[model samples]
Target: MSKVKGHKSVIFDLRLSTFDACLLMQEKPKVSVTRTRRDSAAKEFSFTADSIPAGGLKDVRAKAWDAFTKFSMPITTDEAWRRTDLRLLPASDFKIPKEGAFEDLPVVPESLLKPLTGEQHGGQITLLPGGSRVDLDPDLVSKGVIFTDIRTAEREHTELLNKLIGTIVKPEDGKFAALASALAGNGVLLYVPKNVQVETPLHSVLWGPGTDLAHFSHLIVYVEDGASVTYVHEAASPNETGHAMHAGIVEIHVGKDANLRFVELQSWGRHVWNFSHERARVERGGNLDWIFGAVGSRLTKNFSDLDLAGEGSVGRMSGFYFTDGTQHLDHDTQQNHLAPHTTSDLLFKGALKGKSRSVWQGMIYVAPGAQKTDGYQANRNLILDEQARADSIPGLEILADDVRCTHGATVGKFEKEPLFYLKSLGIAQAEAERLVVEGFFDPIMQRIPFEGVRERFQQAIQDKLSVDK
Candidate 1:
């Protein structure tokens, strides 16, 4: 398992012990030669605490398996995983998700079998193939609101699950969120207590069934203080092509004067494989609104983050994505403004066709005493096919001496004077390029105020602008 170019990664099937995978490359020897690297893997901190299924937190899962063996995955030496490529994944011959049922998986879709919003929008959770099903609104659980099943709140809410599980995307913070904290086991929890004002809106759906499976999902949202909620998170795949692997973790905590509204949707299946890590933290005078949408998977790498920790906090992030054929979608985003009149805003939009490829990297940070911070970031892309490719990178960093940061990025194609002004009004250059690509994704799907995830993101942009491309 240590042959240079004949590569074998996905951490060589996770049971590490080649001197614990070279312990952080023998202490960061220049991160084992990076710059455009092509295979220099090692950084294992070993995690396999009997694959954790509630065994009294064996000392916090042995420090989350030593932060998933100190973060390791060889996406050619991580420059934010340099343009995502896992050697066209057969990811070390996929394993992990076995405990099958639901009559041996694969067949979902009676439109994802009920509940994609419409229980007056209140509570819902659906993760099938042997586990997960949650339903709420017993008068908001008689007013204390602790929506269930994250291993049943790790056995009846252990003091709010040991103070908010892994405290903001930890588990060595990388290496596929330390392999989703070493194999995620049944997740879903939404607790909105203090000043509770739920007024209907909570939903979750994560599905991964047969064919070479490996699916892990975990979600935690705690909105307290001046509470308010509207949540929805989803991931779906089934209808095999043989090869499935999804790694996920989403953790959000918005307290002091809290209010949170997040709606996320990912449509996986194309012999899926997605790596994920999502985060959020906003305190003093908190408020966060995040809405994101991604079109399926055949290879996706995601990294999302938002931290505006305290003092007049507010964060807004909006995203949209679409790709076709040889799909590969990658996104890395972050907006951090730690305290002092904080504010952060980010926007992302995408489009691609046939020979598919998409990647967006964004960042805006303002720390150092954060005084008067106000940050902004933007990314936009469109390329209908010329062997489609899009990459937008935007960044900004300020060690604040009173900050107001800004960043922007754009990758283009498909703007022939707005498709020749909608084809001189006679419309029909394929319906004026599908109404100019649905008006270029209608302002981030109308800022997603969750009307069933903006009607499944406008029925997935009218089935990719009525295909035929």
Candidate 2:
């Protein structure tokens, strides 16, 4: 793979023996490893490359090894990650699961895996750490569409992979992003040939085994001119308590007149610190839609960036988040209008209960000469308890005098009137709260493209609102 300008490149030769040994390593709390200042009092934890091997096998694995060692990881104190306590993560204890990590882990709960595994989800592929081969749908390959694991892509589509990976989202952008680049391992790459359209959505899963082991993966998607596709990714950890580092990147390119819908769900275990960057570039007349959901993790930092480079292009961004039990979720979003007559819309809703916290920072930029641009952004949050907290910052910058730009945000508890009305109808207080929460989340669900996924998300929100734990 080619290196970026002014950057040195390193390789990780991932081998079975080396990865297995690392996975079995005992958890050793090294909050000091991520410490930014030597004299600081706060505790933090980061993946230690010295504990992982430098070379063994696999070219892509070697690149990951190089990243873990060269890239600067973040300490918990980093402003973006300060709210999510990393000290609780057992990063120091994780090891790569043996060959059985894929099958050994509990069958992914049907509630979560059903939407992704079926033939309707477009195509489904699974990746295993330390060298796992993936099988793709032959029908797609017959259509000249390339959907495979990143490792295979590197070997077969090296030039395309290098041009797209690590370019859209840089690890140096933030602590979480940087860590993902440094530790990237197995991921997926989907390429749609020019003018071809895939009606169904594509699904891929990234599974990291062993306790306290670092899992880094990258996704690179290219939609050639006049092509159409949708992709979904799910990240989760079955083991309850371990320091599993999940850092991943997703880069999408929408060619002229192409259409792409992307969905991502983050459900890393409570003990995991999931950091990711999702971005896309829209060519002239292309269309892009993004649907994101963040539910589980001790702390998560996700950025959604879209660039409208083509005139008359359209983009939509919608997000849903539910945080509880001291969890923290941070989101940074940008809607950039660089061409004339482009339209963009953004809506994000979050509910924080228990001691959980969430932050939404969204911005819109309309460049000069980008007249007739229509841009809108809105964020709403419902705080379910006194201990719950939410922060929303929505802003806009317009250089074109003839542009339509608007942004708004709101943070409040369930409206007392609404709750009372539900209770008066004979609904219990808990049930009343659940109904109100659903009302808050329902509008956003309308934007999801997949009915099956939307149903699951609605049920997830209902469960979160009804349960007190």
Candidate 3:
């Protein structure tokens, strides 16, 4: 492989073979961490078989524990984490929520409990601290659809769960991933059998604990060949003063010719530190549409990746985020074209207010022999306040000479001309600013399949604009 490196970008010419290109793709730069600090932080919480819920997945848990003990927390010195700092996280003060801690479910706020789409979901699941509840349409279930909590799946769908648990996002992906896999009990699973097309969408909500505790959740979505489904997931927490942490994982697999639409909304409380790894793989002729919305958390660092693993596969990612107060949100995304004739597109737009900050780093990679690959990525940021900050980094790595790959990044303040135009029309300054911001996010907002969710996100943006005004 011949390398040509530029600012935040790399281009490689794979003249050897496709296998060689695949091997090189597996190589990642190692980031060193402070061992003493890592060990000190790890000692704060203990994970044992007794602490974890009794069920299957013992081997998976054991492998995850090994990885968790072997890996250390990443530091800011790492390139991917350079823009986000974890020094403010009080790791030693956090405790793992004991089993039965959520025997009586906490009063979830109306905003979180409310349905984003007015229509009823084909299936719905809520994952609390220690327990979960699920409701699915009997017709879908009769059609071989599987939608249930992890515990019940463990008891009933053990073989399938065991086969697909860590295939996409392995425990060794990162330190936090390992930790989540090791203690994963509060989770939901959605499985659609071959050739089944569910007309209605499925929904899942993961509510974080409000206390000074840590929680881990996992999500698996499997769509078999010729199947189609849409899934919406929300991760939220109630406002609290104490510090808390959440480490989660999401794995998605779309079989040959299958179609999957996945939506993820994150609204962690101001006192929570959130870390997660989410990835999706599309097989031959498969299609995937992914939407990400971020508007909460004291600090959030997440990785979202799409792997077009088969020819004729297509993937699209649309993301929008709004940050206010002292919040910090970071997203790292990757579009990997692993097979020929694959297409991928990504666009992420964010707005920052108050003293908040947002970071977006995107990469589009085309493997060798992946000819006819078309990939595009762009990140646009709008800063609403002088103190607010946004960082946009877009990169590309292509090994195929015939592929078309392009990336762009822009970070700018709200344009004065637009605000002035609105103000001259008798709109108030605040209202004018809101209109400008709304227009800036229109492209991404339009991509949202659910109308209610789009309106909810608009209201959230307005709330952020109203803060400290």
Candidate 4:
């Protein structure tokens, strides 16, 4: 694949033999081809409202399935999708496993089981293919905190789930979002009641199914007014030769005067295609701190957004990604200021090696009458090889005359001055490069709240660098 300079356009070659050309000339060519028509694998996969089992969410699934049937997957013509191409994706090869098909759970990686803070988690949930395990501190549960699987919540906390589910991220958001809503059967829910403060962090791990299968997971975090909490989520899978897919969603609600810190780590197998829609809404006087780490997957497209919907609300986002081999990772982010006196800040940093490519598109939007709004966004990328490529686009749209908004983006290679300085100190060339890479990601690493997590990311970076050497 190749990209044009100063534009986010990819050049694809279409090869047709003489017979193919003759057949095309015999019929009127269509202007566009939908995803189902282009992908033979997708034609084999079919779904309807009746396909969903009877449950509290059956209606929700039905509504989403209807929407999914009508909507088509994104194409390069769409403004938001112009930078990425989906023609090479094997959409039909991975089928969603039937309920109760995965009775034997896969072993959880030791790295995932290790504590991120070197202390006990207030609650923990591990989601397998068709089963889940949950653990919560009795003290927190007694205080009205609920941390469990979605199935249990549907049976015990029906009113709460019905009220909050599909509220933050609706099916209308995108095509994959509609599919996820209609098919997702495994998920986690974390609810903190009003005025409750949880000092320990909650953790969740989602392990993908084996080859030729797909896993759709959802996460909901609700912090009521005057409540505070921290949560961490991780998604990963073992390496496999066959294709797989992960379509997921995350919705967060921070109520008035509430505080929440959320961290997400994505490390899918090399044969996986990942797609997700994640969003958070901060109400009046609420605060949200979010961090995202991306390190694996054959191809990924993710959308992350934060809405400052009430006066005095604050939102901050820190993101970091590393790509190698032929991996492609694209992240589209937005920070919207919808109320006066609201503030939002975002920074995304990435490093690319081998033939890998990374794309980052960020925007800061200020709605009308959003006076005293402050918004800022920046993206920086480091290129470690001549064959690697990185694209950064930053934008701003301000309807309010009294708001302040700024955006910046940069893509560059390692500065010779730093390498020379390190070499002058007798540091080996490989070691110097590794140090530079770590320094490039230090700003985002500092924003992580836990020491163990930081060290884990550091180790991951080292491993990537070593492989390159």
Best by TM-score: 3
TM-score order of candidates, top first:
3, 4, 2, 1
How many collisions per candidate? Answer: 4, 19, 0, 1
Report the error of model 2 at residue 224, Å. Answer: 0.6
Q: For candidate 4, what is the lDDT?
A: 0.84
Q: Residues 1-469, candidate 1: write the lDDT tens digits.
A: 1111111211111222223356646765454544433344422323356665554344665677667766546564457866676765665666565455555666557675445455555777777655777888789999999888676787788777777887899887787786676567767878899998998878777877677667777788989889998887778885466787888889999999889988788988878888889999999998999988899888888999999889998989999888888889988888888888988878888889888888787767666776877777777788888888776666666665666666666677888898898789878787788778778878886776656666777777778767655
Write candidate 2's Cα lDDT for 196-244 as tens digits.
9887678877765445566777788899999998888877766475456
State every prediction's TM-score relative to the real structure.
0.32, 0.82, 0.90, 0.90
Question: Per-residue alpha-carbon lDDT of model 4 for 275-372, expressed as tens digits?
Answer: 99999999999999998989989989999999999899999999989998889999989898899999998989999999998988787777777778
lDDT of each: 0.75, 0.73, 0.84, 0.84
Model 4 spans with C-alpha error above 4 angstroms = 1-53, 99-105
> Which stretches in model 1 have alpha-carbon errors above 4 Å?
1-60, 73-82, 85-116, 124-135, 139-146, 149-152, 155-174, 179-217, 220-231, 234-263, 266-292, 295-300, 303-418, 426-434, 439-451, 454-469
**Residue 369: error of model 4 in Å?**
0.9
lDDT score for candidate 3 against the true structure: 0.84
Model 4: residue 299 alpha-carbon error in angstroms: 1.0
